[model samples]
Target chain A: MNLQVVYCNHQTAELDIRERLAFATSDQLSNAYEYLRSHFPQTELVLLSTCNRVELYTAQESQDDAPSHQDIAHFFSDFHEIPLTDFFDDLLERTGPDAVRHLFQVVSSVDSMVLGEPQIVSQVKEAYRTATEYEACGPLTHALFQGAIRVSSRVRTETGLTEGRVSIASVAVGEFGKSIFDRFDDKTVLVIGAGEMAEETLRYLSNEGVRRINIVNRSPDRARALAERWPGAQVHAYEKLEELLVGADVIVSTTGSEKPIVSVGQFSRIRRNHLDKPVFILDLGAPRDFEPGIGQIDDGVFLYDIDDLETTCEQNRIARGTEVERALEIIDDETDRFMREIYHRATGPIVKRLREQWHDISQTEVRSLKSKLGHLGNDDLKAIERSMERLVNKLLHPPLEALKDEAREGTPHGLLDALKRLFHIKD
Target chain B: MVNVNVICFLASYSVVLIMELMRLLGRSPVRRTIMLLFGTAGFAAHTLYLMNRSNQANLPPLLSSSHDWLLVLAWISILMYLFLTTIDRNLAIGLFVIPLVLFLIAAAYFVSDSSMPVLNVSNLRDAQQAALRRWVMLHASLLVFGIAGVIVGLVLSLMYLVQHRRLKHKQTMQRGLRLPSLAVLSRWNWWAVIISVPLLTLGLATGFGVAFLSDEAVPVSMADPVIMIYGVAWAVMAAFFAWLLTTRRPAGKQVAWMTIWAFGFLLVTLVGLQVLAGSGLDSFHAGGTRDSSGLV
Candidate 1:
């Protein structure tokens, strides 16, 4: 089995590079799958494209069909219409056990900018689901992603990595929102989208004691649904967005719109009444629901996009470096356990056949000896058969131990081939 | 049993403060537990020392002397600290509350540990002195609880400002300096100001009542400059307390700032008076105080 990953993350590349390279939508991802299939038909792929990183994981049954780092890079270059040289230095590659470990680390959030964030796990799960939907994933990729998610849970349970501030909502509110306002109970929290992200940010806000919540969306039913989950949260029509925006002390917009929903002119008008009163705006949208210029509308307008929070996230990462180390330790252990299982799966058929072949030969020899020594006492024949069985078991132990040991690092392909030829074992 | 002096409990509080500072570097359950243990041990030693002092002086800790009075204040503050910490280990109330405790214990050293003038009220008739002593106890008791409220207000205000600054700056809650929510702290601070200022007023009124009740031999008169200074400090607090109640829309930051000033002035005046009166620099109080250290 061959496993490989090519990726560019926040640590390796800037946001612009990642955003350009990301498969932003399901349609785009499905198209990427089509392109990948045409290029590496024998390979299984799982592409994870988030705002922070764009990663492509591939696995193959035959080593010959395993695409090189350069091939994946070329695919990114060609699909995005950017030259390979433009991002070749930024693209990183991991193969075999290293690839397996990387996915585990990513899923566990040890590799995330925010060390213990839970969003990465869901993002990875969603990526895997998309891959399966497009028929891009096979047994190898399926097993890899599934193991990655399972290890993610272990890392969370065994380590303190997931203890505090584990989401963008918590980080934004706990870090920025708390800093901006003296108290949340008196503040107005306006959520502009009725999506999961909006609900998540609201959860953090409510935890901080924000009572007056105004959830406005294009769909009134969606807004009502989200409002119902939290008490004291009011639903408003999308037309009343400006009124809600002006009233909100802390505004978190996560609309799934493609372009900027709030332009500088629109927010400038909203700020007429709230010039001195500070407004903390968290634009968690991918394409950005609010224009970047809205951040500079005034000194009172404290605007933060997802990328703006990287510095705060990095500080959180350093603060919890020990938790990261402990989480990584679990990930490493789980990775090895997973790799050993895959290796055992590969070597199981051959090992079973070899054991059956040797046992059959021992039985035949015992039978023939029993017949030849028919003149001897029956007890003597039985004793001789037991001794022959022990002799065969002793002979098989060394090679079998060697095969098991070799399977630790990887499939013992060379040793298995030699054993098959030497023992007349057929698979 | 060995004697546990003020220094013993003071040292314990110092160690708790140091450990609280260390908690700011990172969150550690062991560190928090160790700090609380030291705090508890310190409180035990403090209790022992106060009981010893009160027994030796033949008075309650509050009525014993200026030194014991300060320790009593620190003791109640520590009690509140322990209760808050027990409820929420993450509440970092100690980071704000413990320094005041340490200061009170240390300040006890500078003030006179001698028995109050009422203790040495030998010149007055036995019945008159006895009545004066009861009034003095009521005065100190009211002041101890009331001043506890002042210190609480001051701590709450500081917490409010720090929490506000962190929230405004968009910084993570500094590692272990977690405080109560602003709403809770503000409400507590408001109550601290409102409740404490009145208790302090009644305490002052009782002190004046003692003046009128006692004869000239003890020399506790309302005309004294020390009494006048306390009256002025009371006015400062009263004015702020009134505003806190009347303000239609009280901004937490504004209220917190004014509370810091009002409570801060009250503490300084109270301690300044004790220090001055302890030194026998012509400062005024009830009867005649004998400096146990005989420093004068």
Candidate 2:
């Protein structure tokens, strides 16, 4: 059995290259799998594409028929309509044990941008499920993926990497919100857009003792739904944002707009009304909800965006480097152990057929001897048969033991061929 | 069974503070164990010290000398710190409480050692003497509790600033220094202010009653610097309390910062004036008559 992976990750490629090469949606992944099956009919494939990395794992029973890195790169070129020269150098390849270990690391989140994030494991599971739905996975791919998930579970259970400050929101609130305010219970929390990020931030704030919560969204139903979920929270129309700003101590904005929702002039006018009371604004929107210049309005107002959180998250990631090393070592050891077990299973049929052939010849000889010695006493005849059978068993033990021991390293293909010739065993 | 001294507990708390600092680097079970051991040891010694002082003075710690009185305040803070830290080992409350403990202990060194004179007269009314003693005890108790509230408010404010800074800088919470959420801290700060102002008002009222009772014989003046300083501290606290009660629109952070400044000023003035009085720098002690038996 041969297992291989052709991939590009944060370490090997820039974000732009990864984005360009990524299978962005489930539909895209299904199309990629169809193309892979057409091009390499004998191989089993699973495609895992996430924001941080894009990996293609393939396994086949015949080593000679395994797809090359160039063939996979051409698949990407053909499917995405991007020339192979554009990103061929950025792609990396690993085969055999290394491929297995890489999948383990990816599933365990050791290779994630956020070292111990829980999202990558789910992403890997989804990718495998998608591949299975497309009939792209066989026995080898199934075993490999299952082993990777189990290893990931073991790593999480054994390590303290996920013990504290695990979420981006927790870090943001702990690092920035506490620094800006002396207390939270009395603070007015203004949530803009009522998105998931807004809810996450609000939950953290609510635990901090925020008594008043104001949720503003363009959709009144969304605002009311969010407000209804949290006690002491009030829903307001989007137009009341300026009025809410006048009383708000902390502002969390997460909208799905393509442009900044709050301009500099609008925020400055609100700031003038709020005066010396410090306001902490967390802009989690992709296109930036509040104008960047609002951060420069006054010292009293503290603003943070997604990129600002990266530096601190990176520092935390660095701190867990030792844990990452430990997780990787475990993955490496498990991969080797698993591969050895797989190789041992592969040698089972040949060993069984050889033993059956030897036993059959011994049985035929014993029956003939018994028939010829019919006049002898029953005990004497039985003793002779037993002695002959013991001789046959002893002779068979050594070769089988050697073959079993050799399978530990790999398939032992050369040793198996030699055994077939020496024993005159037929296919 | 070795006898523990104030120095022993003081040293223990100091070590605990160091452990708290070490926790900022990384989480360690050994460090946590050592911190708990030292904290518990310090609390035991602190209890013994207060008991010893109370027994020696033949009065409750609050009614004892100012030195014992200050020690009682420190004891309350330590109790709070121990309770909080015990429940949540991850909280870095020692960093906030330890410095306050050290300050209180240091201030205890400069406070007057002489006890409040217990006036005893056979011919005078027994009911009046009992009332006077009760009033004095009430006055001392109210002030201690009020001052304890101030300490809590100040600590919460400090925690708020630290938490805010971490959030603004986008720094993650260190493993061992986790603080209460902003909402919780703010609520506690509000409670601290609300509870403290009433206690302080009662303390001031009882003090005035004691002064009025003494005016018949002692020519006590309200313009005394100690009285004036205390009056100013009371006024500042009262103003803050009024603002808190009346202003429905103040932000929690605004209130937290205001509480910090207000409580900070009160603490400095109250401790400063006491130290000044003990140092014999004020006009009240300039006479050098050594009438340490005066009621006011």
Candidate 3:
């Protein structure tokens, strides 16, 4: 038996090449599965296509039937209608244990662009499910994907890989924003600018169930465009910033202004009546949209700038990095155990057949001896039958031991063939 | 069949407090489980000890004696701590609550263990004694509940201060030390004060009413040191509660500080007077003589 994977990821290929190679839609993935099945009928296949990677895994019952790296490259070239010269060098392949380990790492999110992300496991599951729907998955691929899922779950539970938020926006909203307010559904969210980080923070806050969002930006068109993406979000004139800030329970500021937008004097005036009410301010701007003194204005005004969040993000990054080593160790151990199970599965039938055949011969001889020795007592006959069984086990031990040792390295086809001919074992 | 005593549960709680402290280092599931085990063991022993004391005094634990009263308060605190910790494994409530429990139990050791003489119904006739006993039970129950609220308010305020400090400094929440948001803590603390003061006020009113109606030639009076001290504590708490109600947009940190002071003074006065009364100081609620005050 053979296992293999042909893939290109963010680490190996540029985005342009990866985009050209990715199967963006389910219909495209189905067509690719159909094309691979037609081209290589004896092989099992699963295709995983995400924004960061495009991977194709194949398994075959015999080593000779598996597709080579160049064959898969040609298939990609012909299927995606790209010349082989364009992406052939970027595509990489792994076979046997290496292929199994790569799949484990990918499912565990160790190979993700964002380390410790939880999406890759579900993506891998979806890819396997799609392959099964297309009838492209077989026993070897089934065991491989199932084992990968189990290993991923183990790594998640046993390690702190997914403990803290790593991104600046996530840390701002999840780490600090969540700790200040119990619920966000009733709170008003004010977005000061249309910067990318501000949009990301808005997304995080929106997911936390912020219903009312007010976006105020220098450019009305950009603010309108940002408002359209999330439901219930309204665009406002920049002059209404103070009015909006007065009502907002959560504020995300990412304007590109050269200086602070809301200074101590301005915020203090707005905060006069709302001193007791808590307001979370995430100032993601580089030049500090909210002044540093504003956080100290009152107990309820929680103002966090980029520097504050980056420190937390860096700490989270370091924590996640430490857990990566532990996750990799788990993945490596799981891979070896999976490969050993596969090898044992390949040699199982022959071992069972050899034992059964030897036991049958010993039973037949015992029956003949019992019939011939009619004067022997029942106890003596039982003892003689046990001796015959022991003799058969002794004679079968050496060949079985050799086959067992050979199965450890891989499937022992050479030893199996020799045993079949020498012992007259049938298919 | 085994003997249960104050020392048994006190040692168990001490161990549990040490385990709760270890949480500051980091989170460990095994350690949390063991801490809970110790806490549960201590609570069970405490319950048994209270039951034994009630049986010995031939009364309910709440009205038995000063020692039993203090232990009952500690018992209630442990019950809350165990319940909260069980519901949310990550809450650092035990760090604040268990120390107060330990303090209450330690205070129980120094105070009077003898039953209140005025509440001893065996020496008096059936009808009037029954009325006095019922009033005393009401007084003790109200006082115990009010103090329990004070304990809750103290813990919540402490949590608010710590959470406020961590947020102001922009430090990430420590592992195993997760607290509720400041809003939740502050709101709960406000309720704690608002509810406890009224209960305490009614408790004091009932105590005075029972004292005046007593059939003794010399009824308990305002001049009694214990009653005077309790009156002063109640006044302070009432003043704080009135300020709390009237103030619009009171800062959470300010409220937290005020709650700590008001509740802290009341707790010290309540426990300190009892200890002094136990050490043979002349007061209305002291144990031993039949002429002593009956009200808690």
True C-alpha contacts between chains kept, each model in order:
0.18, 0.35, 0.57
Q: What is the lDDT of residue A198 in candidate 1?
A: 82
Model 2 segments more than 4 A misplaced: A1-114, A118-160, A163-261, A274-280, A284-289, A296-300, A322-427, B1-4, B118-126, B214-219, B281-296
Error of 3 at A145 (Å): 3.6
DockQ of each: 0.11, 0.18, 0.47
Which 10 residues in a row give candidate 1 chain A its minimum summed lDDT? A158-167
Q: Candidate 2 on A11-76: residue-level lDDT in tens? A: 999998899999998789878888899889999999999999989999997877789999889988
lDDT of 3 by residue, A1-427 (tens): 8999999999999999999999998789879988999999999999999999999999998888989999999999999999999998899999989999999999998999888888899999999999999999999999999999999998887776776788898888888888888889999999999989978998888889989999999999999999999899999999988899899999999999998988899999998887888889898898989889999998888888999999998887777788888889999899889988998988888889988998998889878988998998999988988998899889888988998898877778999989889888897
lDDT of 2 at A257: 86
lDDT of 2 by residue, B147-236 (tens): 999999999989977876665455666655778766577778889999999999999999888666544534457787887888898999
Candidate with the greatest TM-score versus the true structure = 3
| Candidate 2 TM-score to native | 0.58
Q: Which regions in candidate 1 have their CA more than 4 angstroms from the true location?
A: A1-160, A174-188, A193-199, A203-242, A245-249, A254-308, A326-427, B123-125, B286-296
How much lDDT does candidate 2 score? 0.81
- What is the per-residue lDDT of model 1 for residues A1-427, given as tens digits with 9 covering 90 to 100? 8899999999999888898899988788888999999899999999999998999999997789999999999999989999888899999999889999999999998888867778899999999999999899998998999999899988876655765564577778876676556678988888988888788888888888989999888888998989899999998889988878888888888888999989999999988755656688999888899998887776556787876665666666666676777778777888899899899888888888987887788789878877876787878877877887788789989998999999997978899889999999877
What RMSD does model 3 have?
4.4
Candidate models: Cα lDDT each: 0.82, 0.81, 0.89
Instruction: Report the number of the highest-lDDT candidate.
Output: 3
